[model samples]
Target: MEWLDWFNDSIAYVEEQLTNEIVLEEAARRAKCSTYHYQRMFSYIAGVTLGEYIRRRKMSLAGVDLQQGQKVIEVAAKYGYESPTAFNRVFKTVHGITPQEAKKDGAKLTSYPMLTFAITVKGVHAVEYQLIEKEAFYVTGLGLALGKDMEENQQKIPEFWNEVAAAGRVQELLPIMDGNSPGVLGINLMTKEVQEKWEYVIGVASKEVPIGFKQYKIPAAKWAVFSGEGPMPYSIQDLAKQVFTEWLPTSGFEYAELPDMEVYLDNNPTDAKFQIWLPVRLKRA
Candidate 1:
């Protein structure tokens, strides 16, 4: 429950900082995890990116402020929008009406409250997983830098995969497979603060950093590897949410500040198999 306390503390911090410039490192410090995994796990468990959450929260408050007679430009500037136009665009998207409408009496508005982390089980049994220590190795592949905008990254990832497939990049990478890690890897180079952009590489474990491919190192650590069968991404994504929200809180381990992997075993249209590797360490008593 200490981790849960810490995770909730992180949320409180995010809520408090919404009116100021949010520093993700501070939130991760409270959560006791890497900025990357803290934000990554947040997206997985909450089914929305941390950025999107923040945006919703800002808009929700903006609606209230507008209803209380704050001018639209003032509300926009308060929420860090550079211009009233940008703020008004997002405001309508969130509240399903313009800021002017939000100020009208008896107008409907949506409120997104601050989130807290808690142990929740969907009546599902313990997720089957294996804890194994892996030696340091390397993966070589094409890399795309992922910025802090989680919603944009969500769309970008599928587009990246589609582009890779359309270009036969997977076939191009198969011959370079040299390490013992299975399948083509969707490796996250999440070794930086959230403010600092990270990379997501679609490649295989190989000793060689071949030309036209970027190479990244996977550090040695114990990983909680979850196996799943069926579909390309949804199956593994669901498993990951279960892992972070259901299993890890009781597993006596903490999410390590390291990169994780998504190993795709097969890419069949109806039956894809995959593994989600999460780096972990024993929780400090």
Candidate 2:
């Protein structure tokens, strides 16, 4: 099946299980993808976290149930809320009113329509990328543990970079970059799954570990190196999203189980040409 079709089928399964205790793993299984990848892709493409999507969907349904004269407690129980109070709070947050208000005459109830995945032709421009293979290499520099919370991670990362700059360490690390891949890298290594801690490294490719710097080895593998030219973050993010949503589904390659690297071409943070290196391998026939 096409990736988009499989994704929509998984979403349909989610909708069917909304009233029951939904198993995210089962949903991902239906999509023939890992739960981690599925959640990440869903958040990127849907513009909402998987948890948020499920919550909003449940609240939307609760509003409908209340409007149909179902008891608030019954609706809450059906949606797996422990109590009507908890349900009301969530319902109000999503629909802008309490469940009781939703049942009132002419009360506007919010509806979260079932979500389906479809590929739209992004015809304006094509992404520029190249496939390359390399031997094992090392990246060495300062690293920090970033928490699972996406919003907090986004805010904290820039501040982390600023702190590194303030310490004047970039100059210290650059001269020692003797590896084949020539550039400082912003690497995110997924260390844990349940709590989802990302170990972020600001490092350059190197052969040996430099003093006072941590080193991570980049394993030998085939990589899809996607380049984008623009200002910080926005351009890189757009390019990455295109890669996951548009390219990966149809590329006949699967994400390799390796740490991805972001290569910053210049020191200018505002306008830099950067490349996102995604490790990939051809799918089995």
Candidate 3:
């Protein structure tokens, strides 16, 4: 099956068994992909990590049960927790209150409803994009492996950039920060499964990078580019979520196994612009 079809099928499976035990590996198996690839593709296409979606769904159901006056322990058991204490801990982490407290005090709780995919058309807006072919470029900067959770990644990425700046590595790497290079590039390395952990580099593009710095060769490929201009990371992240969640599935393309890149356009964080590159191969119509 096609990747998009596989993804839609996986979503249907998740919905069908929302109240049953679901494992990441099992979902990947159903999708006929590796767990890492499945997780990464799901996050890329869903705009949220699979784990986060599951947690939110569970919490939302818990809230519903709490509102219905069901006993906290019974609700917790229905969601697969062995003890109310464990459920309460996770519940409070997501909803900020124990089930009993939520039931007794009528506390306000956040609900993450299951997402429905839809396409909408109103006014037309022009999107600027180009498919360009270029030789491989080397990037040098601070690199780290991120965990499998999107929330954890969102929190750590900014800190990683800050640390690279505070340590003056950006200055040290100035030679590579030429105008053509634009801003620092954030590259996601493609390994096995999408969920499988991979290294991220916060660095600048260079034709000839220094020996000590880790270097990655981005091979010549076609890129679907999107531009974002506004606040620093927020704009960049928002564009990414839109592209993956709203654009990819509908576009006449599917993800190819290649490095995804982000190019910062301006120096100032509050008023910076960036470009997001997604590797693609044309889908057979």
Candidate 4:
């Protein structure tokens, strides 16, 4: 699709300006879309912000420059870092070694290549979804800040769930679930400006908020609901990934700015089944 080409070309724009002062809006110019939507779409498709991608690409090349006898300060300045201290901190975080050590004999470094989006045959396993209209609803639960890094969220979310369950948070919220509402809801709520930054909340659907509970009102919208089976978290998580990586590009629907709802049906490990309600609307609707 032409959209895929424009998005790839935006990546090319970022790569070309890696060593210079990068204008983020220039990426939008290359893609022929607003800067906001381009970055928002990028976060959904790539699972990282455009800025984070640029940072990793710059650090990857900076590793090569350091190993080729460039001074740390020079490499830092070349990549738009203000100080060696800040550069060293980020370099070590990405590469697992100081920039000075990278110049030594046989130093190992991490390299994050530029990303590209494409549609490949994603295999025979079918991904199924349906469109439904839903009224506005509220969920009451505790939440944790979900940042842009997919890896970080993968680690944090399960720990958050564990903490919630161990503290009997689910039981406390269960007393109020409406008959129309599913049991405990695991919701991935994102901000309009940055889709990747989220607050993952586990709560119940209720109009009545308890004294110590937080309530989030999910606005009425058309939804694309998908079914998942097999296991907790992993199965649903994999389904969500497929929905984005495979279904979304070809689905002719863009996500509405709303929270995604995960409804767990039962506690059985072997026969687990759940539903994920993803807010969506027709591309031109």
Minimum summed lDDT over a 10-residue window in model 1 is located at 188-197
Per residue, candidate 4 scores C-alpha lDDT tens digits across 1-285 of 777898899999889999897776688778765454466567767887777788789999999999889999999999999889999998898899999999999899999988988867774778878899989888888888876444566579889988998998788887888888776788777645324556888889998788878988778889998988886657876787788667876789876656777888776666688888878877753
Per residue, candidate 3 scores C-alpha lDDT tens digits across 18-136 of 67878666777776655555776677666778878887888888899888889888898888788888889989988997788788765889898776544445224445667776667
Among these predicted structures, which one has the highest lDDT? Answer: 1
Q: Which residue runs does candidate 1 get wrong by more than 4 Å?
A: 121-123, 193-197
lDDT of each: 0.83, 0.80, 0.73, 0.80
Stretches off by above 4 angstroms in model 2 are: 83-89, 142-172, 191-198, 207-212
Pull out the clashing pairs in model 1: none
Per-candidate TM vs. native? 0.91, 0.81, 0.77, 0.77
Alpha carbon lDDT at 188, candidate 4: 71
lDDT of 1 by residue, 90-117 (tens): 9989989999989999999999988877
Error of 2 at 7 (Å): 1.3
Model 2 whole-model lDDT (C-alpha atoms) = 0.80
Worst 10 residues of 3 by lDDT: 117-126
What is the descending lDDT order? 1, 2, 4, 3
